[model samples]
Target: MEEVIENPDRIEIEVTDVTNVIKPFKFTKDTSKSSLTILNQSIENIDIHEIWNNTTLHICADGGANRLYEYGGDKRSEFIPDFIVGDLDSITDEVKDYYKKQGTKIIPQLSQYASDFMKSMSLILLYFNGVEIVDVDEYDGLSKLMNQLNDKHLVNINSYILNGLGGRFDQSIHSINQIHILNQQYPTLKNVFINEQDIVFMIPKGRNLIGYNSISDFYKGNKFPVIGLLPFSPCIISSWGLKWDVRNWKSSMNGKVSSSNGIVSTNGVIIECDEDLVVNIER
Candidate 1:
């Protein structure tokens, strides 16, 4: 992960087109629920309040509900989650009741096979796909619920998951693993993990435009937003709009993995790859 190649040729990718499509949703300060955001239990003093306000459907994963309740404090009433999901083990009775009274749908999935994070993901797919479970209280409702989504039409939604990283090391790895698996199961859904310091997402195979309208639009004051092009599996990658640009760069877990790279593009960054790659940018 530490080796570096100097003066590699930049690959040609359409960054401007990709930026045009995702710019409004990613950069806008407008207060409208245009996407989905999930909160995990490791919530801290995150400054991305605008993301919370702009998310239409917010779901908390069990103890994630607890963290959100505690973080909101005086403004607790203002940040009620749309759905509080997972096994009822981590959520406190008081916090549960508070959100329940506020009309939040509390879903309890008792299956130990999948983690609370995965359970919440299933709930998101079910809700977005318009598949309502009549036996919503079933211990493993999400298990069967996901099956029903096969016949239903699902709209592609961008998911911003918070507190998924910066926890236990194994959990962070698992979260990244789930990101890859989820993309395979549900190809349309784009999942992004948001930690306190970085924003991470999977770059799909072929060309991907990591676009932005302006530098300030994504990172207000940072002249060079630090980034990394990580390879969980073997892949051939090439890039543009970066300080250390690479062409046909072979990357893998045991080989050269691009880390501590910086974005140099005024507008956006473009990456072309033969397989899916994980990308992280400092926020």
Candidate 2:
């Protein structure tokens, strides 16, 4: 059999489109004391509503639905997830009933083999492929559906995952592992993990040109945004469009890991890598 390389075109990722999710805060000389207190204690400000609005498809992982509900508060009615998927472990009955009444697809997979995050990912695959009639009650339903498809049948979609990182220590590591595996299995699938502080995704090997309308599109208010070109494992990288650009730079955990590097590109950064590198940009 002859070898086949799918999607040989240069991958272009735009982290700027979703930057509006983080609202910029501005204070005036006439600002009231109570308004300042509200601004300081606004936990709701970090919510994923803006990201949710920006994405074409939104799937919540198990307890993630509950988090969305609480975050939305009185405006919970305004935002409804397209699909709620998991082992049905953390989602409460009240939360489940709430979305169920609103016609949200609540899928419960009782399999211990796959995490809630993976289950949601499978649903995303099925959604984009237009795979109708998925057995929501079946254990490992999404996994089984995915197993039935070949590489040519698997299409790429820009997926934004909320609440996948910055949780419990072990789970957070698992989230990163899942992101890496997903990239390998589906090269075209653009998976982005929206962490509380930064947005993380993989930069595929080759010369990647990331373009945006302006530098402020990805990093608003800040003149320069902090970014990292992290090799989850050992890898050599060369880059451009940064304050401290390096040519053919070697990187690893024990060696040099580019962290807190400033983005000097008025628009975007370009990187060519020997291996897939984890790219994290401060939001």
Best by lDDT: 1
Please give the CA lDDT of all the candidate structures.
0.75, 0.64
lDDT of 2 by residue, 1-283 (tens): 2111222112323433221121111111112110100001113546654555555666667777777777778988987877788787788899899999998888888899988777777777667766774555568777777765564466656666654566477877887888789888876566766555777777767677555556656556445677888887787776666767777778898998889876676645677777888887777
TM-scores for the candidates = 0.89, 0.81
* Model 1 alpha-carbon miss at residue 244, Å: 0.8
Candidate 1, residue 241: Cα displacement in angstroms equals 0.6
Worst 10 contiguous positions by lDDT, candidate 2: 32-41
Clashes (candidate 2): 0
Q: How close is candidate 1 to the true structure, as a TM-score?
A: 0.89
* Tens digits of lDDT, candidate 1, 164-191: 8776899889999998999888866677
Candidate 2: TM-score?
A: 0.81
In model 1, the runs with Cα more than 4 Å from the true position are: 1-38
